[model samples]
Target chain A: MASNTSDLRSPLARARGLGSAKDGTEHWWGQRLSAMALVPLTIWFVFGVIRHLGADYTAFHAWMKSPFSAVMMILTAVVTFHHAHAGLQVVIEDYVHVEWQKLALLIAVKFLSFALAAACVLAVAKIFIGA
Target chain B: MANGSGRPLSPHLQVYKLPLTAILSITHRITGVGLAVGTLLLTWWLVAAAVSPEAFARAQGFIGSGFGLLLMFGWSAALYYHLCNGIRHLVWDAGKSFELSDADRNNRIVLGAAAALTVLTWIVGLAVW
Candidate 1:
């Protein structure tokens, strides 16, 4: 086992040996940390959206363009995607039995979350910047 | 040994009665996924706003439609449920409320609070709308 030439396992398989990744706590802690941040942020978001209910485009756009709303919107989007990805990763791991498919889905989730978060930030930034 | 084939498996989901705590535990995950899905609507709304008034109006029009309103209602309920249960989880993380009775009671409390909050939100939303 000590000699690389004697070992037949592929690098990926060797790296994926059945042992603790030693980073499990990162996922747990991140979920909790983001959940805490989201408590107040989600509350603020719910109330804000309700307040804007039935408002015209100009009115709604104005609210979205406001400084506080813009900042909170970006914060909410970023933290939310982070938290959501962490969560969906666990769900996928638990349920997806096929290894390759699970890996592909996990990668897709991460990429989709990042892309959506970026789109959200750009939208808010564009509106708030008025350009 | 690598393959799990021909082995007696443990009783699966429908094999036993689930307690309230267990149900809510799974519900937390369900709502978490639902909220993740709901985020797409949020993104669409924002992107539409950034695009133009016309785009925003179209977005608003769809959201005002019956199907869209139903989705919003479901999303809000899921949000409140997730929020309340999430706080309960945070408390558990702090090493409190591990008692079975406490967990059971908190499960009811979380469900009741989520329901009340959801109803109150829609009431207020419609009133102001």
Candidate 2:
């Protein structure tokens, strides 16, 4: 590798880590914000599932078809996937050292998270809208 | 080097004993990863329901099976742990509980609460089942 000593940057400037991506802490803030939203969504989801525990197809379907239940399910799906995507990104970046592997995993994570999130919302919408 | 005398260096992670808080910190990340993986199950359930009664039946059969129940148990535990520890993290983000003793105490509290909640959930779940 060639050194760029011709630049006016100081050692401290280079050592200050990867610097900013101009986006700042958007990712960090998104994770926390999604997490906050999930705290209640998850609790509601768990209890709701429990209430319908062992419920037959008709019961479960009817419950899901309810307006409130459908809305909550969609919101939970979106927020949870968003939070999961951000969390997995941090985990991958921490442990995956190979450049190509890291890039591939990041892309896969992003794509899969969004795809699953969309699938979930679509599923709920089908149930809700009776489509 | 300033310490060219070959003196003992500060202990690195491998050389140092991990404290309770350190263990809990890593557990938090692990549970977060597990929950991420668990989302596939959620998607499967939702999609199955949206499909047809037959598809939903298959999904329900798997979930009600022994292996499926085992996976549910694990997912519930992971979810509860991640949720509890996540709240602790949010609190830390607010600049509290940085004290060594307080952090350690809070770790134990988080662990206990997660375990208790998981057991209680399962107990209620079984009753409903």
Candidate 3:
């Protein structure tokens, strides 16, 4: 009963999230998980590209129509870009000196990454679903 | 943590001779950035394929151009390096290969693997089509 009254930590301190300034471990682990997933997917992708070298749109369209390849492509796009954004944020935080410039770049990178991912997903869907 | 004392702001890169581990660590970040850029090109190719054969051809033509091919080659090199170094990093994450000797050997292996993989992939690409 006395321990409750004697506790010194403020509510703000008690409620503080985690890791360097309340958040980071999760982001760190996110990069690791995504990287692990990408290892096989990237290898598969490289081989797939090699197999399709010089093949025209018709060939690609045909190959991507398979639910398996289409799904893998989508997953790769999402995880890779998310991982890229996370890594790039740290790079900018480390290097970019000007506050506005860093903020602008961080925003731009996220926008481009997410936009590309969305477009890739839609494209894969269009081909996979024949829509 | 800050007083107006004449203190070093940060460690200068030029002062110290970087070891292979440090060099590869920096390369990891550089390739990470390069891959982010390379994804845009991949995205374009994918969208064009999704659009029409003509559009895809146009995309292919650009990518097949000499300059475009060079860029793609560089991108591929970055990709291979990043992926290889990434695996090395994951191994470190498992709390292995932390010794300086291990760092030296493993980092060199990562570089060699990246180079070999890049060249091999291109060769396979050329032979296939």
Candidate 4:
């Protein structure tokens, strides 16, 4: 009977590997969390952009000089990039079946996201600090 | 016995009715892709601002042109849609909205809020300009 197959395996073997893939939940949860963080942050950033629309360079600098706006902008940039990375990672994972290509893309996305986020934060800091 | 080869499967799109949820899901992917490209625009804007007034003006000119404005508007819409739907996903992640009625209600709310936010952003842009 087919029951013999189940009985042949150790209990540890049967219980240890019942899932599709390990550590997949982290990706799922991070994507969800970053998305959640982006909700209010994106809304705030949109209004911030609108408030600065038509502003001259000096005015734009002044607007970003505000501590609160600067902080929010940095946070928005980081969170948005992180959210984008998570979204794109899933897209790559689903569609890019080539092993090396997928791995390279995943790494490239992380690098770009981090670099952009860092640049945004530095720009915000410089704007605020007059550096 | 002679055997017959099976008929080719009909294409899925012919049979698949485009549902609201399906449409929204596809739009979410489109907006995600759009936003990814739009990030380059944001990076350019920031870098220009950081560089010099001349550079900033150049960036502004690009962003102010007809095509640029159209792209900006699209980006704004994408941003709003992604945001609202993202919140919807968050709620779903929390194990809520499993009921059909609640799911429908949440979908409507997401769509409506995205529209409202996009309109509001455009209005604010118009007012500013």
* Best model per TM-score: 2
Residues A44-103 of candidate 2: C-alpha lDDT, one tens digit per residue: 999988887666677778988899999999999999999999999999999999999999
Q: Could you give me the TM-score of model 4 versus the true structure? A: 0.83
- Candidates in order have lDDT scores of 0.90, 0.90, 0.88, 0.81
Structure candidate 2, residue pairs in collision: none
Candidate 3 per-residue lDDT, tens place, A1-131, comes to: 33676756566655664534666478889999999999999988888777776679879988899989999999988998999899999999999999999999999998988999999999999999998
Question: lDDT by residue for model 4 over A1-131, one digit each (tens)?
Answer: 34666467566655664445644467677878777777778778777777876566788788788889888888888877888888888888989999999999999998998898888788778778887
In candidate 1, list every pair of residues with a backbone clash. Answer: none
* C-alpha TM-scores of all predictions: 0.87, 0.88, 0.87, 0.83
Give native contacts recovered, as a fraction, per prediction: 0.76, 0.75, 0.85, 0.42
Off by over 4 Å in 4: A1-24, B1-15
DockQ of candidate 4 is: 0.54
Q: For model 4, what is the error of residue B15's alpha carbon versus the real structure, in angstroms, after optimal superposition? A: 4.4
* Tens-digit lDDT string for candidate 4 (B1-129): 123457565447767787787789878888997898788888777777777778878888888899988999899888889888877777777888888788778779989998998898788789877
User: RMSD, each candidate, Å?
Assistant: 7.1, 6.3, 4.5, 5.0
The ten-residue window of minimal lDDT in model 3 chain A covers A11-20
Provide the lDDT at A43 for model 1. Answer: 92
Q: Which of the two candidates, 1 or 3, achieves a greater DockQ against the reference?
A: 3
